[model samples]
Target chain A: MIVSLTHLDTPAALIDVPRMQRNIQRMQQRMDNLGVRLRPHIKTSKCLPTVRAQIDAGAQGVTVSTLKEAEHCFAAGIRDIFYAVAMAPGKLPQALALLREGCQLSILTDSLAGAQAIVDFGQQHDTNFDVWVEIDCDGHRSGLKEDDKALVQIARLLTRGGSSLCGVMTHAGSSYELDNQPALQALAEQERRVCVSAAQRIREAGLVCPQVSIGSTPTALSAQNLDGVTEVRAGVYVFFDLVMHNVGVCRRDELALSVLTTIIGHQPDKGWIITDAGWMAMSRDRGTQRQHRDYGYGQVCTEHGDWLEDLRFGAANQEHGIITLQNPASLDIVVRFPVGSRLRILPNHACATGAQFPHYHACEATGEVHIWSRLHGW
Target chain B: MIVSLTHLDTPAALIDVPRMQRNIQRMQQRMDNLGVRLRPHIKTSKCLPTVRAQIDAGAQGVTVSTLKEAEHCFAAGIRDIFYAVAMAPGKLPQALALLREGCQLSILTDSLAGAQAIVDFGQQHDTNFDVWVEIDCDGHRSGLKEDDKALVQIARLLTRGGSSLCGVMTHAGSSYELDNQPALQALAEQERRVCVSAAQRIREAGLVCPQVSIGSTPTALSAQNLDGVTEVRAGVYVFFDLVMHNVGVCRRDELALSVLTTIIGHQPDKGWIITDAGWMAMSRDRGTQRQHRDYGYGQVCTEHGDWLEDLRFGAANQEHGIITLQNPASLDIVVRFPVGSRLRILPNHACATGAQFPHYHACEATGEVHIWSRLHGW
Candidate 1:
């Protein structure tokens, strides 16, 4: 059944279908031009319909952060899956199960112990697991440094353990901090060079490392060349948020995801219009706090999707959002935003905000909404 | 079935049932002493078992932030409930349905327009909603200030529209900012005074306002006198978190909710033990950031629930947490927290963290885990 924006339940996760499709097309076209497979990270949406849209727009396999997502995507008929996080030792059995069920599920490892566990599990199960060595292009988070000797050590251990050393992957996650084109492009280049070098070093050590995967939403969109990279994995670009907007990757108008809420009450004297979309709906991801712009909780928009330049959702509790006006000089908030009026709030981090809801109200061009169920939990 | 913490799934939400019961007993005892009914806000834990525990421990009814919560709780045989958020015009039908289904559900309204909507909906549906006027005790979020003329106007409108003017309710949400007893006690007094005054004003205007409700976790625990207040509602006190720890309400040992995570990898040079419990499991609630102590993402504890004083979850990504050693002088993170080792992380906000999971692994004194399903979304 088709539902309009007005009919949607308050505090609903609304995916502007046209904007989402445009975002998908933009990222897919960029990857196509760079001659690299675009393994769109389904972690951002976790909704099958959203993943299907990405695949329809020329995306290759899906990149997942959790085993649950891999299983969900596999159940939705997408066989090629990559569990991107460093594989936990106990989670090996789950990964093996996915592979046994005809899923091209690739697991990641950055340490010898991780690789050895995979090796042990592979040998015990008589299954050669497809494993990728995670390389750290930037010292942002977890991964074996590209120049570290452990890269080849892990690769060798995987092969010795009867597991297939598929490739080396890296995420220049710090690219999210860069707001300029040059900085983003440089990080993208560095991410490409380092990850490719890791793949080369692994191959030089008598290991077959075929794929060199690298990306982050910012790096994927900014890279001028992929060079030796086989595939790019990026999330959040599929539903551009305030963080991506401040990172100079996408315009605010390009953001596809928003929380549809109703103005429940008002503190007229404080010039605050309270809404039902609190941190629970918008998420506590203050991703834009240190960015070029700090959208406290989110940027408020009209029910029609027009930006409310003067209004910003500054503070949020469990179930109440305190939306205050920037210029409160002459504004009578209670008169301007009467109770029961609906509003759309664009979140700071699309990934975090999208995770708050169980499903997305996919809004089409004709104002119709389709409920897209999301995969939750591990 | 009995399960040790180490044997349970990694990145799971675990509720320390014993500690929760103690927390419940403490709050219920205090409310009993104050001569007021305890309507525990089930928003903190939308799990039926958790709410059942509260009800079992002398809680009269439940306070819900969303209609979905009210519906979920009502289905579990909890008939009396307070839909705390100001009524949205569209949700009147849902409330009416719950009311028709024999739920003694109470709705809140803070504005003349909001009250009018309830009145209009009540008249249109031929249902009289037990409406409560929300008074703003502190300049925190939503509510009409206690002295505001709109309070009486809203109540009058509710009475004239064939709705029962139940009472006035206020939450001293700003009490969260107070860490000292003096400030908390004073704020608690303020919350009680303002809410009672609003109730009196409504009565002086020839309307029946029997219920005078007020609270917040801090205020509910600190209030010395109830005076004219009929009931107190508070959430988060059930499973105290790091925020409550810093609020001087609960000791670190008293925290009942902790994310059970497994150390997946290590950044030895950076003194970081990477864990599977990311912000996705612990949530991005930095509620303690502005408190007396900033516990980064969360405070680390041993698998047995003992505080790991030297460790703290400093940062988190989608599926990875960077647990750093506070004293890295002689600490070998890789050796101390070996890969695959399990740990428990007490959350900054129990309400936020618990919402991330589909169910809580309720851990009893014997280390047995019982899956308690959680209600998600509106």
Candidate 2:
């Protein structure tokens, strides 16, 4: 007795297509107003349809974190791609294939050894490759210091060795750790300074560094200036989560994706309601750790996607989540939900949880349902 | 220039088949020595070859965490299964299908509400089901208090209802938090006390408590007594990891599975080497936080499966990992590995990381490699 749309299985991934389209348009409009190219990172939503929607919304190119992602997008006829992560020599064959296929492929590296390896591979294969030096903007992850002399040396080596230098790129990953818009803005400015400084150093070394890229969803959404950045790459903004909301990047209403789950049981005495959505569905992303909010797994939502007042996923295991009502005793509502009641759970990090599933049940603005396949594995 | 094995691809998954086979046999011998039925949990490997090996090693039953796993095993001719996770009403259809197909399915539940839901569903579908009342052994996750009167009441309900009460089950999930064998033994004692106590209570109530089940790799391997217990379920021992080693369950030598990665680039001056395995290849599971072994992501290994002394993954993103040498000043070896140099990474938790991949490259005891398909989706 499966209802057509109301009663699907619990702990399933659902995408609101209209909300996704709106998210894409909103991001594109922001980039346009700031006079920067939008290269939506595909790591957020690995679905081809979502990527296509980004392209359709006026993205000049797209960014990917893996060769598998680049290959998938390139095969799908996306002409330009930035393999934003540092590329290894073993990926040379795949990178060369994308280049041979007339796709504008750009890769990143932060070390001289990496540059030399790429130079040797390019020389051996008799094919030129575009390269970007990754600069550390805020010391969050991998990158070369903007003022590091080694970077200029590596840029000189690549340029002189026939490798096409494609300028510099930096991500303010630390922006995610900021508490407010001012801190995020400061990080954004720091990101611009580092990337612009690195690019200027490369240009001063008698090389053309034309493309400067800086990105972070927080920075991209609120940064006042993109005066030096040519392109921005941010992924999480398209499907904002509770983490994003806590960080003040977007409001709760702006979230476009959630795990649709069912209320299976209730402990009326303890006011504990169990849902089918668990760590396997919502992911083990404790993204709100730095913030004041300890959203156990996620924030519970009403059937129509509104946030349920003061409800939380208090505890979760691999496949079972326990919801403890914040004020269990005071609620006047029917304490027990029926066995088949459906609810949506807003995730803490959309990318991690969404990656766990194969396909998304796309709900249209008119309430039509369609299936969108997501790419998985390496 | 794709080499048949070595240069096939960078950052690929690798299985030490001989080692895994030995691991399987070792666990089986332990179970046999204890005179307990072994129900190997398939959630760790999720590969059919590994599951087949467990069957070959004398496992009478298998434990599964998801319905997808149950479906896969049932199709593969696995007759006896313990859907170890608490059952939800939404999972009724698949559970009923498996039962109808003659697969012996026993589910675990902690509360009377959950049991009653299953009984109602079974009665409505005209199907009989088996159930195990879950007991809280160590307050690690979901379960009923050992001395709760409700346990006896639920046992009575299941006995009189259409469902058959098989016995009582408990998992010492807190055992993983232990740092030594003595601590693990203490947790095991806690596990035994709760399970034995619950079984005794049920028996005193005139219910036939035929089986007492206890699980978790640490407790399963270290338990001194199974006076009232009939079965043991442990998953991670098949692919022992850094976390397991740190927790004194198994040593590094016993680890059987690893992610095969390639050297993609290097930052010689910064002492940073980049590999293809990131959080995607390895998961974000930093198991047992008190271990103090800052396995940045995972331990680095040579192509032949030996630990690369002084090399460890220091940082990771979604698809890129940065490896740092313990001593950066030493230039005794070439500062940079060539692109395509293969490496292997030991995972922190086998179950979580293994689930991300769609298939395993099954390596046999004789060093034969074959592709094993994985089960995905709902």
Ten-residue segment with the worst summed lDDT in candidate 2 chain B? Answer: B1-10
Worst 10-residue lDDT window, candidate 2 chain A: A331-340
User: What are the runs in model 2 whose C-alpha is more than 4 Å off?
Assistant: A1-5, A149-162, A263-274, A308-315, A326-343, B1-5, B266-270, B292-294, B308-314, B330-342, B364-367
Most DockQ-accurate candidate: 1
Question: Interface RMSD for every prediction, one decimal?
Answer: 0.9, 2.8
lDDT of 1 at B34: 96
Tens-place lDDT digits, model 2, residues A1-378: 113457567677888777788888889999999999999999989889899999998998899987788889988999789998877767778899889889899988877777888898899888888998899888666778888888889898888888988889999887777768788888888888889988988888888898899998999987888888899999998888888888888876678888998775555557677777767677667677667686778888877788886777877766667887777788632344554577788888888888878888888777677778887887
lDDT of 2: 0.81
What lDDT is reached at residue A99 by model 1?
A: 90
**A208 Cα displacement, candidate 2 (Å):** 2.9
